[model samples]
Target: MKKLIILILVQVLFTLGFFSISNAQAPKKKQILLIGTFHFNNPGADAVKTDDFDVTTIAAQQELEKITNQIKKFNPNKIFVEWEYYDQKNLDSLYQLYIHNQYESYVEKNFKNKGNYDMYVQNEIFQLAFRAAKKTGLKQVNGMDYPLPMPFDTVMNAIHAAKQDDVMAEISAYTSGMAKEANLKRKTMGLTALIVDLNTEKARKINSGFYIKTLNRAGQTDNFGGAFSVAEWYKRNLYMYSIVQKQIQSSDQRAVILLGSGHVAIIKKFIEDEGLYEVVELKDIMKIK
Candidate 1:
């Protein structure tokens, strides 16, 4: 009996020691910062377009510097932008030009036909992501944007097919009114102020509410306008998350995602659900120093 008891105690001690060692060797948790930003160029391309807010102004540039400084505190090892994944080569070429002080040449060659070069230069991808990558000494920025085949016309066709003209009109008027209100606020409050407001918990919750409402209302008609619209949006974000995930090699990697404010609520939720990352809020980082 005495020998048996000693043997049992020895096994228990060995097991405990092994577990302690294992715990100590476990990898550290990865930190992901999801930064929701207004497009600096103000291209007026989104569903809710704000009046052009120029980031090239001295005051705007100064404010952008402050924002980037705060972001630097996170010390992200990788930076991802909202540009399409397939266009990553173009992004890389642009970054190379940016670093070499050949930005004008790059724009004239690649983007002269797309839109205004000055406006493109001021986009958050260049203004924020490029600067962040440069500041952190990162060699390149990653483009994880995937454009799904959903368009306004496609959704409208579905609605029309279902013969839900009334429903479509009502939703359009409601959304357009909301957009006008938001645009008016942006004009009144200034760009930084508007962005700060949008990054708040209230704004996130509102976005979440809007998403839920869309999902609920989409199934109301048999033609599948609302449902298809919501599904496409959801799929886009999910694929974006998957692309971001692919860039993460180990738990030691820390990433900062620069995307539109509208995407925050959905992407944040997906990150939380993954159980592998700890989402670092910009609000928390802004409070530091």
Candidate 2:
């Protein structure tokens, strides 16, 4: 009886050890944090340049500190920004200056005291991503933007050609409302609240929902411009996400993508579709308004 019991116990131990080894060898999913940030510079480069509020002010700088502190807590392995992917060299070289504490000198030299220098200087890349990277001792901030121009106006052109007056009115209201939301929130709730709103799930859903559902009705029978335009938008975002993927490797356990809020929803969708990464919601890490 003792011999039989000893053999059974040995068999159980072997099975447990095998399972433990398998678990240990299992692949780890990279945790990605997608932070949808408003353009502090408000350069009018994008279709809807949100958040025109001056980030150069002391109050905005203080709020930026809180935002940086929140990102530091995430302790990402890599930090990615919205510059063109091909500009990684230029981006990192500039980041190197920021890291060496020569940011002011570099800015002065590069800008040559140009007008609207404040706009260039106070971009959220400098205020948030660069600051958080230095605080976290990160050596490089990756540029993950793919310069695939989204043909947004094509949908409108199609609608206009089709003479969809009601449709045109609806799109106009949505775009205008987006701009208003930023301005109104900034005035009423301040910078923190504006950012919180920009990063919220409700914000993303509302932004992407139009592209997914309403745009289908944009084009007439001959040309589905609305649907095609939407597909192009997703394609560009997916490519940008791939640029981020190239930067990440097996060793990287976590990463943060600091991008304009417009791009976040589509990339988040791609991340979900892959089912290989765990996304960390920006709102979860942000402080209470």
What digit string (tens of lDDT, one per residue) describes model 2 on residues 1-289? Answer: 9999999999999999999999999988889988887788887886554656877788888988887788889899999888888878888888888989998787887785787677559888888899999998899998888777667788889998999988878877887887777677777766777777777788899888888767767878998888888888788888899888777988888899889888997788888988888998766777463
- Model 2 per-residue lDDT at 167: 82
For each candidate, what TM-score against the reference? Answer: 0.81, 0.86
What overall lDDT, based on C-alpha atoms, would model 2 receive against the true structure?
0.83
**lDDT of every predicted structure (CA atoms):** 0.77, 0.83
Query: Mind giving the per-residue lDDT tens digits that candidate 1 earns over 1-289?
Result: 9999999999999999999999999977789888887777877777765566677778778877877787777778889999999899988988988878887676778778676775667788998888878777778899999988765676666666666666577667757876877778766775556666777778877776664564335434455666677778889999998998887776436899889887877898898888888888766676632
Q: Which residue pairs show backbone clashes in model 2?
A: none
- The residue ranges of model 1 lying beyond 4 angstroms of the native Cα positions read 1-28, 108-114, 158-166, 219-221
- In model 1, what lDDT does residue 284 have? 68
lDDT computed for candidate 1: 0.77
RMSD of each: 4.5, 3.5
lDDT of 1 at 7: 100
